[model samples]
Target: MKNNNSICFISFFFLFMFMLMNMVFMLYFLMNNMILVLEWEIISFNSMNIVFSILIDWMSLVFMMFVSLISSSVIFYSKSYMSSELNLNRFIMLVLLFVFSMMLLIISPNIISIFLGWDGLGLVSYCLVIYYQNIKSYNAGMLTVMSNRIGDVMLLMVIAWTMNYGSWNYVFYTELMKDDFSMEVISGLIILGAMTKSAQIPFSSWLPAAMAAPTPVSALVHSSTLVTAGVYLLIRFNNLLMSTDFILLLLLISGLTMFMAGISANYEYDLKKIIALSTLSQLGLMMSILSMGFKDLAFFHLLTHAMFKALLFMCAGMIIHMMNDNQDIRYMGGMSLYIPVTSLCMNISNLALCGIPFLAGFYSSDLILEMVSMSNMNMLIFFLYYFSTGLTMFYTMRMLMYLMVNEFNLMSVYCLYDEDFVMLKSMIMLLLMSVVSGSFLIWMIFSYPYMIYLPLNLKLMVIYVVIMGGLLGYLMSMMNLYSVNKFIMTYKLSNYLWLMWFMPSLSTYGLNYKFLNLGQNLMKNIDLGWSEFYSGQGMFFILKKYSIIFNIFQMNNFKIYLYSFVLWMLFLVMFMLMMI
Candidate 1:
């Protein structure tokens, strides 16, 4: 017990120190508007250079500060939450490692250190995800690792392509790439890397599937550090991404991802999975705004979302623990009456998630919507952005109603007591920050206020979406979509949307089916059918026959056996001599 307390305190103390330093760095950069770059040549040969470096600017400092703050809180929370586990120290160590990896990712400016951080995150995350040592955890870990490996391979490709610039320090060459025609392939590869990390479009299934991890890991990873890493990478590379047709492609992919995730969240039943889908949706929103050349806006939203989503996940974790590890909202109701504090925090996070007025989520999400509304985008992108926004609110309301308003459906009253102060303590900090982060980030990032002029109805478009989505969500949740006749009638359409257009299956089973079939064919025609016959069966048969023919002359007695062996040796020698 004492040792666990020490681990918790030591981890929190170090994180707090890093957080304070990040604040100082943020202040210094704000005052002077200077970027601090530290570099040393680590390897140089044959005109190739790989530099180890750190970039200390407003972006890195601010992001690192958030990472530290959240990690500190999560470590403190885990001391209580994971107290009974036999491997509590191991869990804390893994959490600390995850935080360190994220810091490495944030401060890295050169491709070498970036890849270092990148691979470290992938490896540590796989370990953390599979920490429970269950089948679900194992499968989730595999999906997470394999999905991220694509990004790692893409980063290697980018590293090779950067050889053209003579250095792997992209911080210096971003401007060059922006205007050079030669940098197109590099740009595409960078986008691919970003997509794989951010879980955009076809790469998104792993985000929701990662819910098999422990809730503290979910709060720390999906909510803040890991999922945002890709978006942050894009922000760093925003200089290179501007004015490219690839931006338009990003707009399309991100918008579709938002729509897809939002719709899927309404149909999702798992408590953590719903929130997981919401994270995917928010990631899409950030990517969409970034694609529109609003890098600061995306970063601001990323930070704010991280705050509330982490809090939200922490609260969900408390509930899941109270509910005996059942994550289905369908089995929960009237929890608000029993756990008022958690319910309040959960609802606040959900409302903020829904973009309610004056909350932390509002400051960034509202601006992004207005700016997107004013931009001269095509109808398709425009529709996707706003419609997905409505879908987001729709799912939020449905989840809220089911969780708080319906009858208490838990199987046992003993399942919950609603008095975990340790868990509540961690959530309270993020709760406060989630309420404050959006406005704080805006003031920090935006030096000049934008003059967003719009007509009355257009300005209130967000409100309209929220209102309509709430009403429809209430009715939709109340209606019996699972009734026998209704389900049969809407089977195909409901199933399609509910399963996220079958993307999980596409990502896992669909591709595996093809590969397995190919392997089966090879086993039949090549291995067992032909190669085995020629290499093993045929050779064994011939050798056995020759051995049998020779065995006919063997003797059972020891002297006879020795004499026969000697005679055979002499006969073979004489035959060789004659042939010669």
Candidate 2:
């Protein structure tokens, strides 16, 4: 094989291993496990040919296909996007490692292996993000590494508890399904780990921080590799997630994340960071759906999101490369005239991302929305979700409008339209698949025997809702009522409204200093309190002034030997008395 910097070899290698791994697991499942074929399992298995896990079923195969597809796209994107970058071989190696870990994560028969894959992906992603080793990249990498490690530690505790009380197979979180005291405590801890990895609510700070990497790395981790590891964990423990306590926590976190991230993305200027926030919203939506017992819908969204998001990121990368690393949409206008193909790919991707009709995003997002609307959450949750979806479309269309529709300021000209054909070709291929695959995937999901409870016919109506949402979003963008609008200073309203959602990020920033000062004050107070109580200039202190009598006497060698002999004699006498 010719060693090219921009080839798809590593991705292809991961895909091959993904297929092989699933095949091996499927054979094992059929050979040993009973074939009851739950309707849901059948639904999951029917989507893709490969099935791997403790029991190779429909769900496993579907996830396997997602990992393979997204990975392949990322690898193809990486080739041309990273052509001129240094350490090309090592980059591919890390990419291979990341894909392998995700594959291993999903296929592992037990929790231990899944966690191993989970941690592996985190490790590889951090390294890949900082491949350039600059200060900003290193800082982002370290932040992500620390957050992920905290989650890993929580997971390790869960595993330990499981092994101590439940079976070590850890295959299904089967132990968590039990009503034992220990299982109850341990299950909560496990969900904590999931929240961290999935970037749920409070743990989501690390995600936006991670956008300092190369665009391709952002595409991979934010889209398919690292952030979604939490979703994988949730599905793997579907049985546990069905429980009321865990479901509530998942719902709370997921809902908050959806609302929070949408607003944050609205405020963001860096193109990659906006995409990163969008991933957070998408993951939150998936997590919320999964918590509502719609695992299939969640997984479907995950698969589709990966396709569109990877395309969007890659398109952004192409444009960024042309514009000399300027990722701000403020400087990006008239790109549609210069790079029509890339612009179209990105436009279609944004449409899909906003769940606009017929594209990949619509099918998945509508399904999740439908499923969520059916849940018992209050009206506030419903409003949050609906508004968040609107925000999703709002920012996405804002990006598209800025890049493809707005007039270019030719004065600050830097780009000369040197598009990489290899990169363009790969993007075009994914663009086609991203548009067509959503419906096919929806069909595959509905075709399964187990999803009888789900109404496949609602897809059309769902598509209609998606279209309405996207149209509203587009009109708002055009009217200059939102971020992209030049005439309307929606800024004043956005400042207040958006801040309601974004206060968490602001508060977190402020709290960092407050917490540090509070800790120092707390320690100082404790020292003073302790000194007053234990070493005060009072009666106790006065007694301590003459406490030498309570201490052991200092003696020369001969006197010390005499003291030791006396202690031995007393011990021997005591032993003899006891024996007598």
Candidate 3:
């Protein structure tokens, strides 16, 4: 127990110190407009050079600061959250390793170094996901690792392709190779890799499945390390991905991902899964705007989202802990009555997620929306943008309703309180950031404010959508058991929405069954039947027949030996005559 406490304390101290140092450097670089690159050549083969490179600039520093802050808070929170667990030290180490990998990824401009960090993030996250020893954790770990392996392979291809440019450092070649076919392939592959990492559309199931990990892991993964790695990579590669067709495709895919996640969150009942889906929805928002060339806006939102999302997860963790590990929203209600402080934190984070006025999410999300409206995009994209925004509010309101307004459905004897000061302290720190980080970031990141010339109705559209979505969510939450169940009447539609449009099924059973069945048939017919008979069992039979014939010769050993001696002497005499 003392050992675990010491490890957590030491980690928190060092991470917090680093966060402070990075923030100072971020401000200094931002003010000076300075970028420092430190490089050391590892090997030179012909024209290709592999160098270990680190980029120190405002962007990297700011991101590192935020990552360190969140990591420190998560570590401190885990001091209480995982207190009773036997392997708290191991958990802390895994989290630290995750942080280290993220840092490596943030500072590298070289694709080779980026891949080192990228692969490290994937490997460490798999360990963290399956930290708990259980079948569900094991399965989730497999899904997470396998999904990320696609990205890893894509990055390896990128490394191979980038060799044509005579260096592994893509930062120098992005503009140079902009019009080249190799650049196009690299851009496409990078986008695919980012898609899997960020849990966009087809690769999204693993995000929710990953909730089987410990809550601290969830907070860190959803916020900074695993998922955001993709967005950060795209931010770095934004220069090369400016092709028209690529942007259009990314816009379509990311928009669909946003819509799918928002709708899925509304239908979800698990507390953690709802938050995880919200993370997915927000990631989609970031990717979509990034595709439209608003990389700065995307990055701004990424940092702010990290703040509140981490706070949100911490609050959720406290609630789940108090609820005796029950994750179902149906079993939780009136939590605000007991754990008011935690509830306040949850509400603040939830509102920030909804992009309520003056919060962390509002700054970036509102700007992204307004920018989309200003663009000459088609009606489909416009509809997806507004409708998805409303869905965000819709699900947020619905979740808050169940958590704060509905009757408490747990056992009567339970005691729930915000007595854990360690957890509360961390939540409070993030809560303050959630409230002010948006405005703070706006001033820091943008040199000039955006000018809007929208008419009245167009400007009010966001407000109208928010109100309508909230009202609908409230009405849905008010439905009684005696009332007609609309979901029961429309089973297929409800199930489709509930199951994330059958994406998880498509990713798992839909994709696996045919291949699994083929393997089974091959094992039975080829491996077990034909190959076994021709190789192992058939060879055994032939060897046994030969052995029996040899045994028969050995049975009459004395007579056979005498005949062999006479034959040998006659053969020797014949050989000698021939030689003469």
The TM-score leader among the candidates is 3
Tens digits of per-residue lDDT, candidate 3, 301-374, equal 99999999999999999999999999999989998888999999999999998889999999988888888888
The 0-to-1 C-alpha lDDT of every candidate, in the order given, reads 0.87, 0.73, 0.91
Ranking by lDDT: 3, 1, 2
Model 3: residues >4 Å from true position, as ranges?
43-50, 482-484, 512-580
* lDDT string, candidate 2, 1-580, tens digits: 2476434675566675775675565445544543322212223455442323354465666667666766766677777777776667777778878878887776566666677898898898788768878998886776677667767988888778776744445554465456667656666777788888887866777788788777877877877778888887777677765764778777877888898888777666678878888898998889888887887788888888888888888898988887777888777788988888788888889888877778888788876767565667788777777778878877887777777788774355464666788787667767886898799778766655433244665435444544555676567545643545642456776665444355435434564446657878877876566665666555487687667534435434567678889999999999999999
Model 3 pairs whose backbones collide:
none
lDDT for predicted candidate 3 compared with the true structure? 0.91
For model 1, residues 1-580, the per-residue Cα lDDT tens digits are 8888898889988998989888998989987998899977789999866567888898889888999989998988898888888778889999998888889889988887888888888898999889889998888888888888889999999998898888788988798887787567777888888898889989888898888888899999987678888898889888888767888898899999999999999888899999999999999999999989999999889988988999889889888887888899988888898899999999999999989988889999999999988999889988998898899889988888888898878786465674688878888888998888877778878999889999999999999999999988887777774654785788898899889889889988776446667989999998888887678887798889989866765635577678889999999999999999
TM of each candidate vs. truth: 0.88, 0.76, 0.90
1 against 3, candidate with superior TM-score = 3
RMSD of 1: 5.8
lDDT of 2: 0.73
Query: Which parts of model 2 are misplaced by more than 4 Å?
Result: 6-55, 172-176, 410-412, 448-580
Assess the local accuracy of residue 383 in candidate 3 as a C-alpha lDDT between 0 and 100. Answer: 89
lDDT of 3 at 46: 100
Q: Which structure is stronger by lDDT: 1 or 3?
A: 3
